[model samples]
Target: MLNYKQKKNQPLKGNRFLISVTVLGSSGPIRFVVNEEDLVGAVIQTVLKSYAREGRFPALGSNLNDFLLYCPISETEALSPWDNIGSVGVRNFMLCRKPQTETAIDVEKSPSVSRKATGSWKTWFNNALTLKISSH
Candidate 1:
């Protein structure tokens, strides 16, 4: 506990933090800024909604629980899809930066080379079953 003299000199404390993020998106890189104290779900939802306007972002967490998250800056310098605000020390931070990617386009437009559309496990399993049956 602080006396009147000490308390007056100390600044007030509350939820305040800054964090940056990097995401790998289909359309390339994107960035965002958010409060550190925000909920993990809110942060991820914001990032996905801001950058992935055309697709769905699967809940990123432990055992698909939808609560796990990451920090922006650390001594090790690692990045996660779900980063927390307090993890970094700042009031605002970049929340997304999807590295641009290069994919080769074939003039023939072969179906084999085309990227698979967004799908779930069941969809992938069904496709695998179809391919297996067709091959046999």
Candidate 2:
């Protein structure tokens, strides 16, 4: 019979693998062991917990849905929350927050107002340049 110590780091028997997740805005990556079948969402939750436990800076809140996990190779796309972490086949990953949509603001000024502002600046600049050139 194999002991727990002997089975450490053996994926065949333990199904656990070590992976490093770099939190966005963090100074360094946090390493942890996770099961191969773990979902991406679960991995992200674990990472957030570990990040908080370590007392790292830029304290991200406990909202798991707000975070995203991305593979270094495919940074343009974030891993699906339903996908298994092991499916990415990479030990290193990046965690970042989902971008928040900008709030719409009601503007009282019209387009003509902005155009007049720009035209007035140009007129002032041209007049200054003409005066300087004529004086010299």
Best by TM-score: 2
Off by over 4 Å in 2: 1-14, 105-136
Q: Which digits, one per residue and each the tens of the lDDT, describe model 1 over residues 3-100?
A: 11123465644554444443422323335544454445556555555544645343222221232233423322333434444555543223322223
- What tens-digit string does per-residue lDDT give for candidate 2 at 33-101? 987777888888888889999999999987888887888787478899888888888999988877755
Deviation from native of the Cα of residue 2 in model 2, angstroms: 37
User: Which lDDT value does model 1 have at 44?
Assistant: 53
What do the candidate models score in CA lDDT, each in turn?
0.42, 0.75
Clash tally, candidates in order:
8, 0
In candidate 1, the residue pairs with backbone N, CA or C atoms under 3 Å apart (3 or more residues apart, or in different chains) clash, namely 18-90, 29-98, 30-96, 31-96, 32-95, 36-85, 70-82, 70-83
